[model samples]
Target: MGGTGGVALAGGGAWVGSTVAAQPAAAAAEAAIGGLTTPPAYAPSGRRPKYRRATWSQQFQTSHGWNAGGTGTASANANDTSVFVRGTQSVRVTTNGTGKQSYVRRTGMTAQNMTGKMIRLVFRVDDVANLSKLVFYMGSGSLANYFSWTFHAHSTTAANYVQSGEWVTVHLQWADVTSAAGTYSISAAGSPSTKTGFTDMSFAVYDNAGGPVTYRLQAVELVPDTATVFPKGVVSITFDDSHKSIHDLARPVMDSYGYSGTVYNIADAIGTGSFLTVGQMRSMQDFSGWEMAGHSYANATHTASYPKLTAEQADDDFRKLREWLVGNGFSSEHFAYPHGAFQKTSDGVPVDLIASRHFTTARSIISETIESFAPAMPYRLKALTGINDGSGIGGTALSKVTGAGGRLDRCVNSGDWLILCLHKVVEGTPATSTEIGKAGLTALMKAIDDRGIPVLTVEEAMASYT
Candidate 1:
């Protein structure tokens, strides 16, 4: 699980790793992801930007002699043919129970500074039956200092993690990785900003299924940094939970920049507590060109997790929420999972399957990175953590909004999409991870304006790009 902010929003998390012995090759399946052949869009028509080869790369075609760690319950096998994104084999790891930390480790590598580099992983989850989470780590010798990120495996909110038997490509920025969860902890000196030099790395996956669950890794690489500038890029500014402060504080700043964002409104929270009233939403939608999207149905406090509901209950909730939004004269084509939790029900029904019945797209707080224009998984649309006033793994300082700006810059440089998630906006100072101060919001809007990046509503982006 990623680090959650106040209420339902979150900050940071990382991924999984493992190693296995070589076995006889199996037939390679044709690549299911079509975006790979799409030439890197970060360069000009005639000129190609050069990217230094990966400081370390593994194809998993044969045994890399990496060390495996975790309880005896977990194991990995290489040269597996059943699932792969490239080549004829991948490393498959099977495990049961949560926090088992099943992984393969590669140590004694030449030290490399990963300041501006990106971690690239190609993996697949074929069964969501008992899966809970995936975690990855990098540290120095003797496993003393390190940082890691977690990926939710049980969530049906993300398309890539669904049991669709498709390989997904994920590129994680150095800044997005954190040691928020997992049995192994990240020390202050182990954080990404402070710990750039590394001698070892590993990937691990944990399951809550009680039975067996498996995930396959085709490749892992550390792509070196390069100067990039794509011909075009787009950003979608989003406010979740329908907080009244969004209308009272954030809107004006964004409007001044000629921007319009999407608001994910809890159906039952309108006009109650600190949430936006129906009239306010309408004004923001019609007068400000904002899009009103669906969130949880009966979440009056706007803190409910949909995955906790029974499949029948969740389906009814989605239906009623969409109906309420459309009946109130707001677009219901887009949605955001409450608390960023869209894991499947105990019966193995993915929340996305239900969401697709009501909304065209459902956003999830999966990571902090630029989303692909052609998202491999639309329902579980990946997003950066909420923007806030604190300083740490997931907070942005009000005095310097460059962190937010850097994300926009990455989108522009790669011709990708950036979906920024925020919860509430308030006056003076923000007191929680779920809230950003007015000054912080204004500075972020200014950063977007200065970059000259096109700002689109969720519906607009999907209609135009997907």
Candidate 2:
């Protein structure tokens, strides 16, 4: 139910007893690997590092000397104590309506080697509608020599959509680089990799919606890519909104591949328009072994405005939703934010302060990266972009779905959990952007199987973390 819907999310493989008389061959293979009651553990490949520490960080304190791009304006104020995630002040960037690339840039620094490094940025948008792509740039002092990596903070097609006026953290990995020029990617001359160092940095939010827009930056850090490869990675297929098409279409396909998924259902919407009925969910749960999870209350909007609610209100909303799930004989151990919107409460308490008290694991559609085995924030697990017509293996044929640029390879090579978000599954052409054709779903499952990766439910994947 998020905006980004192109890539995978979390999980590999888990087992479920099917009511179908003809058990899938994949099921037997999965059972042989102990996928029946428990997820199989793969030994770490030890080809990559296991720890990550900040190599460089910025707090926007003092005279940071950041400048705006093109016709935009940018400044840092020591006394601007309005919103600060780290310190007492933050950098404020205002875009001019004329600039296509509105950004804040700072140069004149000693070159820092960023090979195999990831960039982290914490920021907030005054109006999400005015923001296009969230881009990060690294340069070798010369403006012409740089690499740009884009994050999905505002992309409507991406799974992880950061809400307006809410603090969001984005991790831009090396592979996220969309464009590079000059010495950014040296021609096979670097020792470890062809990637070069950077002496300049820029944070950008595109102004695609016209008019001047404002955003704030709290912190930025350069960290090592502590992701590692395992003997086999895991994939968790997840469906949001309890769309009836998922049960009528996706479930049978996944069952054929010996995979059961986690369903985040809106409690109040059960048996409502286009939603799965409780009886249908029961069939999937008891017969297909699907895990029923919480989405939100029935009358809640597609996206939750948690930051607008007081801490007490947020807690009540979350509690009622969980209670609805449990009261209906569903597991309330996990939850997905409605439309992937989560942030601090209106009273300034972090959303996790309230969410952690209700659910064991909280998943957010934020990061495009795979969730680590031991996630840094259990309550805010990163999910890849949604698997939809535009972003994921949806609407495409099997070959294109398992193309050379598939995201599943990253999981297979990194031993991390990839949580894939899906909304609707249709047998014919998709009528909406949220729907993926049956062929696309089948292709994705086959791709995961071809790589010999296991699929697990969210619960199974979290439990297999050890």
Best by TM-score: 2
Taking the candidates one at a time, how many backbone clashes does each contain?
18, 30
lDDT of 2 by residue, 1-466 (tens): 1111111112211111222112454443333222222221221121222224568888677776676555454433433555554556776777765547767778877778765456767676766666666788788655678877666545654333455554565666543455677655522211223455577888877777466677777667776543433345577888888899888999999989888999988877789888899999999998988999887764554455566677667767777777777777875478787756665566654565355556767788766455655454565677654455444434333343256545565555434567777789988766655678798788788889998888888877666543
lDDT of candidate model 1 versus the reference: 0.62
Every candidate's lDDT = 0.62, 0.63
Residue 429 displacement (Å), model 1: 1.1
Per-residue alpha-carbon lDDT of candidate 1 for residues 98-171, written as tens digits (9 for 90 to 100): 55667766777778666545666766665666766667777776456666766445554443343434355565
In model 2, how many backbone clashes occur?
Answer: 30
TM-score for each of the candidates: 0.60, 0.65
